[model samples]
Target: MPSTTAISVRNVSKKFRLFASPKERLMEALHPFRKQYHREFWALRDVSFEVGRGETVGILGRNGSGKSTLLQIICSVMRATQGEAHVNGRISALLELGAGFNPEFTGRDNVILNGAIMGFSRKEMLRKLSEIEAFADIGEFFDQPVKTYSSGMFVRVAFAAAIHVDPDILVVDEALAVGDARFQRKCLLQIEKIRTSGAAVIFVSHSLETITSLCSRAIILENGIILADGEPKIVAEQYLAILFSESKGEPNLDITNERVVGSSANQGIQINQLRDEQFCDVDPSAWAGSLSERFGYNRHEVRTTNGCAMILDYLVAGNGCDDISGVWSGNAIAILVKVHFSADVNQPIIGFELKTDKGVTIAGSNTFLAKTQLQPAARGDTKIYRIEFNTPLNEGDYFVDLGVAEYDGSPGGYVLDVRRSMMHLMIRRKQEKPFFNGIVDIGFRFTEVDC
Candidate 1:
């Protein structure tokens, strides 16, 4: 292993034997023919990857996709049937709830025990006990048996101990999911510190938001194989594609390419066609067949429809242009979505969201939340929905997602059609003055005040 590499796995594979019953195993053992009584199940196959110091790599996959198995091999909780994993330094792994803690031991003792297991001396662990306990903030539970702790308390103590150990490599596997929102935020901040301190972090979580936001790199595993590995955003997109295709019974990751039906843009039409509500009212029933040819249209957009409705066309208009490629910060923009319902629909809802290019959702809203009522629709019915919002965003390229669904009394309702990353909006600042520095401008006012 290179000096800079904290962890490396080369062609690692793990296999397990399955038998119908214990009797089958006994029979196979007694038979002189030595016939096999169990079939082989490969949990991981030829999985290889390396994590360098200061790099945070996220492992993403559905359940039974070898995620946990691969982590176990790296953490030495389980052995690989083939190949090996090398670690350049001590590892602090929070692979599962109560994984390292002894249920019978007090939380304080467990921390010391874990420190000792990681090669720390009793005096060293004693010195760090106060800090760990303060971070955990589990109150009296620190002196109580770990079995008395709740799920949330377990994560708090486990995460506190794991990070305080100062290992060269940190392995976390979905253990933070049990933490409360406040604690999760605290843990993420600490993880960021660990990452900056030059520790290699192998983080496994089903939360795509966290994966995209925190990890420097990402890997996708499927069926004991590495499906995709690279930049976090791209890998996340591919992972979503796989999930969507599988759920729809499609075996391939072919993105939906259904052409937008609309009238063509007139020859020599500018990309920023100034449009707003009046433009939409002029011809509600007319198909803007050429909307796809507009200058601001995103060719790489992903669209999904469930046969109930289809988003026929869309346009972004702002600052005196109907089709705008960019909007000035703090300016108001209108998004027009033309939809065609193929079947009778009741209480349909339309939603809109704004996101950063890295896939972080900045803001989103739906008709249900606004308590807006729409008339029921029949087959062949067509309507145009308009969403208007102010762009208090920093200068950068952003994306807009439009979705149509039913208000089925569920938290998310039922999605009928979705156009993700379909509309690209560029937020521009006046060249003379750049107002904000980050992803958003929260309208901060500065004034001198006496303390």
Candidate 2:
């Protein structure tokens, strides 16, 4: 292993035996022929990977896809049946709820016990005790036995202990999912700090949003095999494709690579610069065939349709233009979508959402949420929807996702057609020294008052 490499696995594989009954096992064990009576299940098959120091790698897979198995092997909780895994530094793992803790020990005592297991002196643990307690924020429970703690409290203390150990490699296996939203965010931020501190982090989660936003690299595992590994966004898309196929019980593993469906002839023309009135004046026939020919189109857009309806075109407009080259923070912007239906439909809904380049959705809304009533549409009918909302976003590049669905008496409804990240644009600060410090500008006011 190289000096910069924190973890390396070569041809790692694990196997388990399943026996139906103890009589069959005893017969097989006592037989002179030593006949096999158990079926073999391979949890991992020749899986190999390398994690350079400071790299955050996310592992995504369906349940029982060897994600936890890989982490367990790396953490030395389980031995691999074949192959070898090398680690260059101490490891801190939160592989499961209350994994390394003694259920009889109090939360405070458990931290001290974990410290000793990691070769830390009791004095050192005591020095870090306050920080862990503050981060966990489970008041009173810190003095109570861990067995009495709720699942959320369990994770808080577990995560707090894991992160404070100063391990060279951190392995987290869906433990953060047990925490509430606020605590989950806190853990993610702490993970970022650890990654930046030159620790290799192995994260496993089913949430694509968390994976993309946090990991610099991602890996997809299917049936104990490494299927896709590379850019977080691309790997996430592949994972989604596999999940969709599995949901339908399809045998074929057909993955579609979607490309930007526009042209380069109009490259010099910035679409967002067009005036709103001009957009209103243009005939649908003028742009229907050339939507991909326009500028500002996202090359990674993924489109899926149910053959009932289709979105022909869309535009983003704000700040005195029908389309926006750039939107200013705290300004009003309108998303216009033109959709056509090929079959009779009742209560069609149109919606759009804004997402960061990393795929974190900032805001989204639909006509149903807005309580807009729409008439039923016959075959070969078309309609345009104008969705306007204020932009309270900080300066950053964002993607726009649009969808048209028919009401199916469900929260998500039935997706007739949906476009993922179809539009790309930047949000700029309207003035220097903007008040917001994060992705969103929720609007805060302050005033000096006499004491």
Candidate 3:
């Protein structure tokens, strides 16, 4: 069934005014100048989308891409010069640190104040006060003014209060990015709880991993317009494609910067359709062009990859099946390999490997693991093989590597790593259960007792 729309935005546009200089503003204040010495900046333009109830949507873009402006508009912190935004329920907005906070007031006072701003009743805030205190972990710092709190403390206290207030919609900006790692994880847990209650979430972040993991759909904005809005994987891929296209992306090959991903290994291969003979392990450096030029390995950040080979194919099912992509966690899918024999090759080692988008292999099985004929044929002959398993991936991106080699390992194998795209799948929780969200669904047994 289609989810119900909880939030709707139609042709929303926001613009800001900037003064040419202090002198211009002073003159304008002293006496209205006939010609205004200011320029108008449009942060957002004609953006429209509907978010379903319980949907977690991510807004991703480069800095100054209007992501923050969009969030602020949704939260109603800033007014749009034109267009419309309808927020249907109570909101928990974790906007910039202390946007609604009193700088000179104690954290405790601000918690109460911010909670009220979120539409929490005085009695309700009192009841959830302990929960906020526990989650925030600010200790005595809660007694001090918010201005005295560190960036970490500011976010923790603010986030804890925002979520614990029982909001029907949540808006998170990049504020959480300032907190330490441990605190970030804690904040995610809280957000997860809120999402399970059928709340709408609008998360804005530059962190692709977080967006891909937590959201079902993602929006990529550039300048003041929406670049793309669809599946998380495709949107992220589109972003990657544009971020590091051949002509204009990541430095070609010789990335002396240690930040480059897969910098050390020459993992050169473009992920096209998959075949058995396609797997060839060759030095990426030895490939046709620069690694950076050939593939998009720009900006080596964690959760980003540098050099890696991968494969893509139609994941099949049924007795004789062929299907791939759009599979979710807990779904069973088959790995179908088309083995092509050339060079009078005899028995070709056919195998498959699955890796995190970061290039870490979590699962791999080959003809060696199964200890079978793998496959054998004369020149120009091709055959098919199959492997099936349960996919227990956490919500994120994954790549599959395919290969074929000789047992002697004389570099006699052709390993083609046309890495599969990072996969994005949603895992829905069961009804009437204590809800949770994360990788792997751990099936648990519970018995109810009636007295």
Runs of candidate 2 with Cα error greater than 4 angstroms are 246-255, 258-451
lDDT of 1 by residue, 1-451 (tens): 8999999999999999999999999998899999999999999999998999999999999888999999999989999999999999989999878798999999999999999999999999999999999999999999999999999999999999999998899999999998899999999999999999999999999887799789999999988888878888657655654553313222233222111224232211123333334345525454554454343456577888898988877777776657655666788988888878888888889998899888999999888888787788777888888899998888666888889887799744688899898776666665565566777787788899999
Relative to the true structure, candidate 2 reaches a TM of: 0.62
Query: Candidate 3: where is the Cα deviation over 4 Å?
Result: 1-3, 28-33, 246-451
Q: Report the candidate with higher TM-score, 2 versus 3.
A: 2
Error of 3 at 183 (Å): 2.4
Candidate 2 clashes between residue pairs 3 or more apart in a chain or in different chains: 262-292, 263-292, 263-293, 276-322
Instruction: Please write out the lDDT profile of model 2 over residues 1-451, one tens digit for every residue.
Output: 8999999999999998878998888888998988999889999999999999999999999898889998999988999999999999999999888788999999999999999999999999999999999999999999999999999999999999999999999999999887999999999999999999999999999887799889999998888889888988657655654653313322233322232226432221123333334444345566543354333456468999989998877667666545443566777888778777889888898888889878999988887888886788777887778888887887666788999889988755799999998877666553455566779876688899999
Model 1 residue runs over 4 Å out of place are 247-451
Q: Per-residue lDDT of 341-388 in model 3, one digit per residue for the tens? A: 454545556666666656777777766566666445565554555777
Please give the distance, in angstroms, between residue 191's alpha carbon in candidate 2 and its true position after superposition: 1.0
Model 2 has an lDDT value of 0.80
User: How far is each candidate from the true structure, as Cα RMSD in Å?
Assistant: 9.6, 9.5, 11.3
Compute the lDDT for candidate 1: 0.81
